[model samples]
Target: MIWQLDLIILVLVIVCAIAAINVKDLLSAAILLGAYSFLLCLLWAIMGAVDVAFTEATVGAGVSTVFCVSAVFHTTRRTTD
Candidate 1:
């Protein structure tokens, strides 16, 4: 059961990653990136790395997502490439 949960988390993380890259909207992509980080944090927690999971959840999901959104706000939403 634990292994199944881990596998599910891993799959979710991968799906989020792919969606983040494939999405054309910058805000959506940033949000998906945050989701990916959260899934990773869950995986880390399952692996018994509490400290790392906490860091990933807080820094990756919180700080990094905020930074990315702020950056998008400061710049144009449309991408040239």
Candidate 2:
């Protein structure tokens, strides 16, 4: 509920989002996106949206991250970037 905490979480979320977008490695990007969603889940929980936070944690941060990492591993091509 504290404004300071909310602001910190918001900053972290923004940084993670930006880092994910900028990173060339697929695995790193996936991890960053997972961190970003988890941060959003924290923000939601702080705002008293427990259900939304749970869904974000389970689907956004959890399943999607796993899928992304698996897909990255399955790719035979390496980053040319």
lDDT of 1 at 15: 92
Which segments of candidate 1 are over 4 A away from where they belong?
none
Residue-pair clashes per candidate, as listed?
A: 0, 0
Worst 10 residues of 1 by lDDT: 72-81
1-81 per-residue lDDT for model 1 (tens digits) = 289899989889899999999888888888999999999999999999999999998998999999999999998678643
TM-score of 2: 0.91
Top candidate by TM-score: 1
TM-score of 1: 0.93
User: What lDDT does the true structure give each of the candidates?
Assistant: 0.90, 0.91
lDDT score, residue 55, model 1? 98
What TM-score would every model get versus the actual structure? 0.93, 0.91
Number of the top lDDT candidate: 2
